[model samples]
Target chain A: MTNETGAPLLDVSGVTLRYKTPGALITATERVSFAVNRSDRFVLLGPSGCGKSTLLKAVGGYLKPSEGSITILGRKVMEPGPDRMMVFQEFDQLLPWKTVLENVMFPLLDARNLSRKEAEEKARHYIDKVSLTRALHSYPHTLSGGMKQRVAIARGMAMEPDILLMDEPFAALDALTRRTCQDELLQLWEETRFTVMFVTHSINEAIKIGNRILLLSPHPGRVKAEVVDVDTASPTDGSAGQLEKEIHDMLFSQEEAH
Target chain B: MSSKARIVMRPLEDAGSGEVERELSFLEKAWDNSGVRKVAIILALALIWELYGRWTDNALLFPPLSDTFAALIDNIRSGVLPARAWTSLKILLMGYAAGIVMAGILTIAAINTRLGSDFLETMTAMLSPLPAIALLPLALLWFGLGNGSLVFILIHSVLWPVALNTHSGFRAVSTTLRMVGRNYGLKGFAFIRKILIPAAFPSILAGLKIGWAFAWRTLVAAELVFGVSSGQGGLGWFIFENRNLLEIPSVFAGLLTVILIGLIVENLIFRTIERRTVLRWGLQS
Candidate 1:
């Protein structure tokens, strides 16, 4: 792995993650490495079983890497903290017992150790950013799938963490909602420019969401290539299709070789 | 053949003529109220009982529903039924609360460690199926002729079900929710208090209901076997005394009191708690 420019905000070097099943020791990722600079939308794009989610979890400090290390601000990642908040794919990530306002304020009031008043104000700001002011008192179960994900995103964003790790946040949403959420996410990013590490299987989403897309191979995922789309072109432009086709051809040719 | 048959499709423009919602008849509306439906069933049952009692025509045998009610009123007026009910309710509360506290301790410990988990599983397996009343004879030998023995059996009946349901509920909390909780740096007690407890509250409430039922029945049954404890007795003893004195209507009245208490506790107290918590949260419909 190459260290680009000055100090990267987050550095994951040769990280190898493994877990034990009842009968087997499974390797999820093999020496997969990348660095996410501050304000970069870094997307880990791969197919199912490619260990992108596992890698994200590793960065979030929920899972430990067996062989290598993950660091943010030169501090070794050991366990989950407010420093790296995760927006999960499932709606159950928001506590059902808590209202939307409370859910967003949870980590703010907790790990951030903010005053209740400060937390509520910050929570409200983020919730409003997600356009969920109307649902401040609603429970997760009462909200639609998209709304739940938005609350999750708001909760993660409210913490103002070093990096926000999103594990296919919009993957469970309906297509129309997914598109809308992605646009909203980009708009939010444009407004704040907070660093985010997004994991997704959708290539179109990868291109649309990431400034730097890291393609991973199928199983025991190893980084195949890091495609830097310096143009900042979205799918609305014809160049996105060109880049998509190029990435597809590269993946297809690699599969043919295998 | 393809050219001859073209597909004809029509979109649903106004599917229900803009009147999808309609008003129901008065009877239909009444049928929708569970309380009304239950009352209707009760009236039908009372009519059957009155007819059957009249056919038998033996006051010594099955007393009429009206006679039973009259007997119940008579006992209440004499302050006999109220005193007995109070006696039973006091003992029931002591036993039920103690049992709940023990269950909570056990469940919290079980979720925290392997040994505690094993202890809970083994205890529930061994004790839950063995009827609590079956322990009364042994309890009497140990505690001897007092409320102590009855409380002992009540604890036995209530502890297992509450612990079992709570353990399972905690275990059944979704992995995603657990991660979300931990991701906020909530560890150990905070994790259990904020995440696990409320997440598994539906099962906890069910366990409470089951424990209440078990403790109530065991209390009554124990009273029947050893009703005289330290010179006072409960409703079960009231029934036993009336039966011995050939007061059949009074015995029925005692039985009616038990049913009434059970109905009120279940429909009022537990129902209110459920509505305020799990039902309000939509965890249980």
Candidate 2:
């Protein structure tokens, strides 16, 4: 699926997003652009105030860019569709009334128009992948935070979307749980090599998960730099630490300059 | 030189290592059982009522609890009380069902569109505060001494609170759940059935309960008015007739029957529903 000449799977060209509150029109991102190729672990990295999440939402078709365009496989993104599944950060993202199996099968039944048996089969398969097969009948509130995220991921993965858009999915988890969840996500990716566009503020996470990273500036986010060839750099070695430090310095230097 | 005087302070051994479990005493266990406690309270109240009624020596106003019980048993054995209760319950069910249906429609509309929500708010605001019994005269004039008048007032009593509570519940459904529904391409009725209903079920259950209570009370009140001239009447009519005939014990029996029915429906019917739904879903304790 690696292509140097063909059009990227997801194309975000000069997109800007703005939202309105009761009084102010807040510009979340401005002229942010990136392309995600098939099977790419593309990460959007930025500081707290930056609009990486907003950008991801725009790509997910939940938010429309105030200016510019986002296209998925040459089709203009207009609204939230099953083709762009999202795994949110909140533990409450899973439907509390739905058992883990039902939560995973919901999108399959709704979007894929699968029969009940087929949906159940597909849902169970994904649940097994996330090691949540034992919790198939358990409700969301009964599950731990990590387990809920797994269910959410299984739900997203079960749909077999063109690209999964994850917005800081492990950010709310404890450190040990977060690490385990990150590892599980990578293992799932290794098995399926599914394309994912992940948004996070953690540099370590970006270095570990993303093959290609897009760094954005602070509030009213704009593209600052793109770090490529991340997969070739060994994560446990001195080079990974060197790269982390260098990116940290670049990000901070930009803030210092302002 | 003072090495012997130097003492070491060490942490307590096996601190927080395990939990202790103990068997409860008979009294403690009985106290823990809500059903047993409730029955105890009821028995105590009945004893107090019997004592007070005997001391006052006023059979016309406050009959002894024992007398009321005997009257209740006599009415039950004659099947008159059961027939009247069935009549009231039948009418209550009809009005309640209709009210619930109307509430469902109004709530669906209220959540879906701006104009629909405005309409619901306006109607509830206008009608909710106006007591259902207050409409009894108009209902009597329009429907004319029948179940129609009773049902009209009963529906009036049931509709507003159900609609208001359902709307509020629907509004309280989280935005993330709505987004999840939209993300799956669910819209219209599917959206409501899949996402909104379950998410807002606790509130909806509360609405149903409030509506049931309102409908029950309204049916009895309306029946009281209708029973005066009608050949056949419900429990309310029975109570009114007993009052007129100076059968105070029978009147107390009629009131006891009403209370019993209320308790049954609230505990058995509504509590069972709560146990199966909101409690099971962990939406409510």
Highest lDDT scorer: 1
Q: TM-score (chain A) of candidate 1?
A: 0.95
lDDT of 1 by residue, A1-258 (tens): 334558999999999999999999999999988888989999998878889999999998888999999999888999988889999898788888889999998888878889999999999999999999999998778999999999999999999988999999999999999999999999999999999999999888999899999999877899999999634665576889988888887666867887
Q: Can you tell me the DockQ of model 2? A: 0.74
- After best superposition, candidate 2 residue B106: deviation in angstroms? 1.7
Query: Per-residue lDDT tens digits of candidate 1, residues B1-285?
Result: 466867888778856686778999999999999999999999999999888988899989999998999999999999999999999999999999999999999999999999999999999999999999999999999999989998899999999999999999999999998999889999999999999999999999999999999999999999998887888899999999999999999999999999999999999999999988888677888
- lDDT per residue (tens digit) for residues B43-142 in model 2: 9999999999999999999999999999999999999999999888888888888888888999898898999999999999999999898899999899
Q: Model 2, residue B24: displacement in angstroms?
A: 1.8
Place model 2 in a CAPRI quality band: medium
**Model 2 Cα displacement at A195 (Å)?**
0.9
Error of 2 at B233 (Å): 1.5
CA lDDT of each prediction against the hidden true structure? 0.92, 0.90
